[model samples]
Target chain A: MATLGNSTNIFWHECPVGKLERQRLLKQKGCVVWITGLSGSGKSTLACSLNRELYTRGKLSYVLDGDNLRHGLNKDLGFKAEDRTENIRRVGEVAKLFADAGLICIASLISPYRKDRDACRAMLADENFIEVFMNMPLELCEARDSKGLYKLARAGKIKGFTGIDDPYEPPLNCEIEIQQKDGVCPTPGDMAGEVVSYLEGKGYLHYQ
Target chain B: MATLGNSTNIFWHECPVGKLERQRLLKQKGCVVWITGLSGSGKSTLACSLNRELYTRGKLSYVLDGDNLRHGLNKDLGFKAEDRTENIRRVGEVAKLFADAGLICIASLISPYRKDRDACRAMLADENFIEVFMNMPLELCEARDSKGLYKLARAGKIKGFTGIDDPYEPPLNCEIEIQQKDGVCPTPGDMAGEVVSYLEGKGYLHYQ
Candidate 1:
């Protein structure tokens, strides 16, 4: 609800260069691929794999992983519900900025709240925001527990852990959904391939 | 102070593709050009010009202008001292991420505090952070108040404005300084040329 300080005094300075211009220079359309799921849901792996795949194909992309962000950008934040919302909000803003600069911004975060993810999606154009839901069940993620987070949450050492105490509202209509079958996780390469194929099929890779 | 939430539970996910690899793909090194000065000192103009110049030369660059960011990324932030610090801090973090993505990130902000700028510099590698001080006097900037902000601040309509009530700390050992004389502002193209020359002279354009 906070408006621009003295809107009369602040005018938008139109840059000589724009998103379309940058896209032409990069030879690719800019977009935010929002990857959401529980911990150990292969979100980071898929995001990193997609980045590497894009790199091999000579495309510009970057992964804005949640853990990596906590180490720097969101270091001041905690795991409190408010902090989590702020965390996703900041990531959403950063992703929008990167996308505006004409780069594929892959955001790998356990964005538990549907409202939070929806808020992020609202920040970008419909075509620019791609929600890739890693729809692995909570039990499967807990079993993998790559970071021993599930154990900590189970032992009551960490409270409000997503999928344990907190809730993860899965996306109702995500652009891409990668679901686990029979407790089997998909390989990162295959998942990345699916995402890249989607982009290609949607004509996001071809410059107009 | 806020160590990455449960440092034991978090392991650094090193991407197979890294800064160097991205730089190689882009054919340009990543770096942050932190442009600091009083308001109306042509920071945005120089940043946009530099971005345009980089584009013409087939280099990827983006300008993170403060006013533009406030319209989106930092809209919640205000002109208070704490808010100002947070604004620069967030900008620094975003610039770092963009630089990591192998693009020249030009951050144009008032950034009146030395400690705040120093904090931003510390977030980046020594070679990757380039401090560019506009170095124009307050009187000249007031005379050229393109947005009439100086008049508002002088008339006491805007409180806590930099160069009116708050202090503007100049950089002690900036990488570049562009000064205005005889109430004349240098052409944005000329200023941008100086920045490109510095990058070229320092061998930032060549990959190691």
Candidate 2:
């Protein structure tokens, strides 16, 4: 039952209130909108915009950004390689829970490793895991430098920082991609709309 | 900023759609119903029963028992002392996230340490963390031994088993307590009714 390192003899308990029933109540399919990109690529902005869009449409959605989680769930984890892997793993599991509760879970993270992201994708049904890659150029994100993180990384103050010292493995076959057109990046609303339309076309907008 | 041990320089991302809006959409206040008791104290039984009861009332509630989480979110953790503490902490954080998503989260765990349980309580507001103590006597729980855990513990096969080898510090001031009436253990429905009534009286069943 434990299925891993140490726990043993534990049994799985099934509840009567299952995912299908929750979906019926919410009137929308539950899924994870996983946004992956480099730092300063407006992942949080797109997440917030998508959340607002869903709310206005009478749909339930939640954003699992690092701000709320780092201070709480993943606070004990650091920026080490293993810590980052564990960090993404925990966030994936939490997102899965939010999805199971019949809400669209928007997870925005600068997850650099492809293996880690793939591992998270394996936790859910293939269709339920909607990966959205923010394919913005490093030059643009570094120029934005919204939080001065890029500067720190360039100055060698922050080692292994994503997009500077560490590599960001873009999603090979993401469900949606938010990229620039004619050298101009789209606004947060447009970016969110791109993902929303994908969700709609995929029949995630309604349960029935 | 990271509040605790390792994470640093992370900023809090505030979404436009918040708890109040989500509560309004769900028509119910979000909170955690934590059921704590001995192994055979019927915590999961009461949890599932209460979940069904809430669903019948058109309320959205999800149960986070070991059956669902230990194999996913907390699979990395074991039954070691420190691992147990981390286990409770992660559950508490996930419950907080569920509450923020505006769903009644039912968490069933045999968290014996008062301090660990209190730490979870401290994560949320004073009124939101409703601790339901299944105050069945140890002898009664041992006699039932639904999972044969007590028999194993008695045979010295399991060390540090709560209520057998480990100490189980009861809650000093819990929100609700379900106990035997006239030497007869209450049915799962009856125990769930006690909590449902409490939720009704406390105005958790509705939102303005």
Candidate 3:
């Protein structure tokens, strides 16, 4: 972990309006739906579907996909270990900000490191961070190979590929897990409904 | 300027629902109100006030203040020229995301460098980035010294303080300027109203 520098001569300006007020105004509680998986595991698809579903229901939500972030906020980062950690760290921080603004932030990333995901959870309140694990088998993902990444990894064109040369640490106690059964992948709509149901069941989708 | 690394083997996943759709659903056009000024010039105050004003008017909005960001996303950054530029860069990207999510994003920071601010403007579309300059004189800010930062800078306790030792290159062609006249600063409500009026005039607050 890198040492965080202390900011001197800086003071926090207290906002007259807070997260609670914003949540009330928005008619929903702020939270982060962190979706973690390997490539071709349908993380981005599920995330985008959930975002659209929430929008249809008049709930404000946004998806922060890894690929889209790499073009903007995380463009300086690479696929190296340290850069990956920093990338996740920055995404987690940004998701925290979105949640603080009283929006449901859906973050889709191949955050293979347990410690990095745990750090993100620690950054938010317990109920605000919901970890959704996409437990698709590596073989299934390789066969799907939506982006041909697995084929390239197999051909030695890519290094540090998760679930290939690199390791993926599955979540021990994820809030929701979308798993494959009998080599059948869940539809994006079904996965999105499961997430929305989880939020609704936990009373996080609406304000009293 | 540092060159952004090209993301190899990374492809952007287009969302089924785009920014225009989100803005239409929210019944408002998305935009970023970038407020720049020296420390103690009431940038955060104005930003918060504008947020509250927008909320009361049935508009979704968020404020990205420098103080709040330092505690989270930019905690590793220090008070150096390069670090400050990076800090503003990240904030601009976040603001762009917020706007893309169909919300009015008010970003308040002491972005003293013209080039850095210009780069932020270039990240977004022409009409989406509205730069608001808090044209408060350095002497007034030093006299107010709400955070005592000016005193520290005067005593040589703080290095590279904007307007003390460092340079503050004001915006060449900002959309709006809130200048203090005769040592009398605009009231927070009045300033907030001014920003709201600007947005209304530009047909951004409500959907046509």
Candidate 4:
């Protein structure tokens, strides 16, 4: 009888699979559209709108929003800085997989640190990453606190709040920046249209 | 002039929106097909077959495979129990999002524990979870040993394996069971046809 611990067993593992070929047949390129911004800057809104537009236009897309992700995928992760890094890291990995399957993944998160966001960007193929910055001013975001998060932070009820006790390093070269200045947000539809246009111009969105 | 924060905010933070509508539009109900078995039990083979079938028949479908997933999303997680649990949890969440988008998600993983597997099933709508047990015996899986993982586990080289160093609890009730003893492994074309036929029979597959 032959024992299982042998070198010959390992050689049997070599097999070539055509993942990219299948992706091409799907008629869309895989890419990650990462959305970074402060709270209430419409990151989730933009992400959701982009998803709707893509679905309506017959493009395969998925959204990874912060709150929803925490309820499931990142449930074990806390709001601590280190945990936050791991959270983004896991999400970045998942988004990469979605891209690999020939689906455009729209990821929306606060993602405060320049280093962390930069690390995520480094993990992907160059053309596959498009960073969208929700560039609303701090004062405006603080005032539009629907979740009462900024208010809690203001009263010192929350610790390590980005844009308060913590910092949010803006993307140095983001693809899109939806800036909210004097009390107006770009309509979610308009924002979604912008993302679709970007993908279209890049030849990512097409009717099949 | 109104400042950014003080403007009226309108966003539904907790709503399971468009899921049913999406199901209606796709004419196919969305669900996650969780495939579990020892490595080399032909999990990936079966999953690829189902995917190809869905594709040719023009149904929206995708597969969240272990090798592809480990190479990307779950890359940071090791074979530790905690890591494995987290890996399943994350994939479950992502699969839920895909289901909500009205796409059939076929997830292939060892997913060794009944507890962890059940946890994944609990995350979705009742009928939206299908557990498929690839019940090829351990000896047969070892004989095939497509990845040589079984040999590695037996040699004390890989810790926390599913069948050797670790355990795999069979499903109490699964939607499908593919056996390799007396029963036969379906060819890619046959498997695809069967899956399409089943989906059509269940009224979960639509062509509109």
Candidate 5:
């Protein structure tokens, strides 16, 4: 009898079709590319670009951005601190499932805290979790404010907003970082290519 | 400004790589084969067997049994009525994500409530949700008593057990029904073959 959290008497069910076979079928290794940054730091843009690039290369990939999940899977959750942690936990578990299904899961979120992000990393074994930091400066992101969220936060309309009212803890040892080049941001395609090349070099592009 | 539940001003991130393209890459249609049954009715066995069969045919699939999910995504839930409902809801949402990721998502659960199961069915659009009912007799499940759960339920050690104290509402119009033929239980491979045959007939075995 195995117990997990509040669940007792649970057993691990081993299926005959495991990850190796799935990778062979999809012709690519399963993994999670976690993109973390502030609201306007281009995390979702990088996720979308990476997904499109991988698809063009005949590689299977899926994006799990806040826009898709906050309404569906995490609908009951609010912007409170506890709810935010639970939100990240659930997304991490779901991303693990997508990786097990032999798809490159790209999770983009304004995951401001390092502890929550590290907890997600611990869920995946070995090097399956690849953290990509959108290392754009606060000033640059605030300047863009594409969604006007920064403006609202600065006006005290949105409480606990990341990089404005709340803290945005940067990753100390992320695998990849996407930042501006000489005060100029790189094109989406270029940033995506950078990640794709990393995946290729790491042998995540093939089943082996 | 879009609002969904407690989430306000959320946007839908539309990635270039979508379900159709993912299906084309996997060479099969993405769907959920939800196996519902009482305890000891061989739902997990059928799931494992089906997964193996799909593997032999060179198709991508993943199993989302309680053993895998209850300890992960749904760990925050419990055995209470409200927790059970939330558990099923989260599973339904995760199964939707798996389907969208272009895999044969096999979700094996003893979801005894009709409302909960129907709620899950509504989550998936069109014929994507294939409900497979394990219509075994209660007596048969009680006799098998796999995991000794039936004995525990009978002894009142386990409260609100399905088919014992709690209800096990059957599916009115599920896509497939697996039960003993002539009072003889089908072998696991035979049962898996039935589901595989259904998928093959439905053109789910190929990417159109």
Candidate 6:
């Protein structure tokens, strides 16, 4: 039989020591930097660039891009709309954990819906979340055709592909939108510097 | 009717650019360091200590400790065995994503069951996974009673308390074991050195 109205003391719970201390030691605050865009619009390129830049400066960071994530964590999850929601939901939860522990988390996904993106925003406080839009025209991404995904989608071969059979709601307001339609990307060095500068502006960097 | 088949060109789905090259430029090798122990066995202590050491050395690394994870990613998950299995499974999936993108993933959890630990081990290739055991005696852990969980278990206040009412299967094989029965722990500097040396021995740090 289960006991009713039983009370347990919270004091008995073992507390984890040194997490906040480690954050303080890092001197810069940790948060999630989510980069959203259409495929081949340069999300991964920007994310990798940013990760390398942070690495060079001795900042603890990791990038969770869409292709890599789908191949692994969300592999069992399918391309259905519900699955997409679940996919982003899982990533949001994981990113919150990463941010809490004071690591710079950069996740790049083709998360097309504003609601999904906003849900992620609600997971963390305003100061801890950064969203970057890699905005490039559909034609341009198709031209690059990095994975030939656009071609497949056009042939009705790949259903629910964003920017073709699917929809991508561009962010109305983003902290930064790097448009590659002009065919210019801030080098990984520049992009990293830009992100760090933002963190600096937010007073996240105290160690340096 | 659903037309589901193997991805026509699954191999071509690989990320166009290599992750290793990015890791090299970042000056770090991606790997997952999974630490398992009983509650109050200094898992978080050692995890943070290791993170601090890596940060100071300018290595890209992140720590996913047990409590913080529960606070976010696994917030809804309970302590039941099935829930625990799902919890570690999710962590393993996420850790695999981080490792694939070329970051050092350090996770410390009680992870009591050998089957659960083995599940995590199987998720990664042999070279990318390293398991460390924190072998502090149950009596010592209860004496410390860091979480007061031990006391609760003794008083019949808490059901299924690991190492007390619940069972904890020891690791059959581990990469390193911290024999802390005498209350001595390696300096963070030493542990960090060991990780770096292991990476070097595995030829993961050759970039200038």
Q: Model 6, which residues run further than 4 Å from truth?
A: A1-31, A48-61, A96-104, A139-145, A151-157, A180-208, B1-30, B52-61, B96-104, B125-128, B151-159, B180-208
Give Cα distance to truth, residue A83, candidate 4, Å: 1.1
Docking class of 3: medium
Candidate 1 residues A47-104, lDDT tens each?
A: 9899999999989999999888888788788888888899899999999999999999
What's the residue-level lDDT of B42 in candidate 5? 92
* Model 6: per-residue Cα lDDT over B17-43, one tens digit each: 346654764577778899898887777
Q: Which residue segments of model 4 deviate by more than 4 Å?
A: A1-27, A180-185, B1-17, B24-27, B181-188
Residues A73-108, model 3: lDDT tens digits: 999888899999999999999999899989899999
Query: What pairs collide in candidate 4?
Result: A140-B5, A143-B5, A144-B5
Q: Where is model 3 chain A poorest over a 10-residue stretch in terms of lDDT?
A: A1-10
Estimated TM-score per prediction? 0.95, 0.98, 0.96, 0.85, 0.98, 0.72
The TM-scores that each candidate's chain B achieves against the reference are 0.94, 0.97, 0.95, 0.86, 0.98, 0.86
Interface RMSD for each of the candidates: 2.9, 1.2, 1.7, 9.5, 1.1, 6.9
How do the residues B10-128 of candidate 5 rate in per-residue lDDT, one tens digit apiece?
A: 77888888999999988999999999999889999999999999999988888999656888999877778888889888988988988888888999999989999999899998598
Residue-level lDDT tens digits of model 3 in B26-125: 7889999999999888898899899889888878888898877888899988878888889999999999999999889999999999999999999999
lDDT of each: 0.89, 0.90, 0.89, 0.75, 0.90, 0.73
Chain A fold similarity by TM-score, each prediction: 0.95, 0.97, 0.96, 0.87, 0.98, 0.87
Residue B25 displacement in candidate 4 (angstroms): 5.2
List candidate 5 stretches off by more than 4 Å.
none
List, residue by residue over B22-93, the lDDT tens digit for candidate 2: 999999999999999888999999999999999999999999995467888888778789988999999999
Looking at candidate 2, what is the lDDT of residue B181? Answer: 92
Interface RMSD of 6: 6.9
TM-score of 4: 0.85
* Per-residue C-alpha lDDT of model 4 across residues B138-202, encoded as one tens digit per residue: 88889887677777778887776778878889888988777753566656566556556767777
Clashing pairs in 5: none
DockQ for all candidate structures vs. native = 0.52, 0.80, 0.65, 0.22, 0.79, 0.18
Q: How well docked is model 4, in DockQ terms?
A: 0.22
Share of reference contacts kept by candidate 3: 0.61
Clashing residue pairs for model 6? A12-B147, A13-B147, A14-B147
For residues A90-174, could you state the per-residue lDDT of candidate 2 as single tens digits? 9999999888888899999998899999998999998999999999999999999998989988888889998788889998998
lDDT of 3 at A169: 97
